[model samples]
Target: MTVFRVGCPHCGGRAHLESGEVRLARTRSRTFYAFTCPDCGEPVRKPAGERIVELLTGNGVAEIGLAPR
Candidate 1:
């Protein structure tokens, strides 16, 4: 499995996470990626662009689509 490096805002620690640890959420206006920091167990979320979405999905990150209101 591919491992991704992400920084945790709550603990200020860098964590290496696998694809199973990441989640991709898509909304009408934007996309977001979320993960729990292994080092600190803090929930982290960040905005993702097309490139990021491509990369994350390619690595097997689970994705959920949000219905537009």
Candidate 2:
């Protein structure tokens, strides 16, 4: 399966992207490409696989966490 190497800017860790549907920790199904940060222990959601670049570069982080205070 094709995977994306995602780096966690917060913890400076890398995450492997998974193919197909993404089931959250609670087993909730999500209709989007996603990745999880092993180091920071965070989940990332992508609108599409092709848009993985934006997520890695600290884009659209709203889905993962929230805006800076």
- Against the true structure, whose lDDT is highest? 1
- Give one digit per residue, the lDDT tens place, for model 1 in 1-69: 999999988999997889998999988887899998888787988999999999999989999767974
Residue 26 C-alpha lDDT in model 1 = 85
Clashing pairs in 2: none
> Residue 51 in candidate 2 has what lDDT?
43
Worst 10 residues of 2 by lDDT: 20-29
The best candidate in terms of TM-score: 1
TM-score of each: 0.88, 0.37
Show the lowest summed lDDT stretch of 10 residues, model 1: 60-69
Q: What TM-score should be assigned to candidate 2?
A: 0.37
CA deviation > 4 Å runs, candidate 1? 67-69
Each model's number of backbone clashes? 0, 0
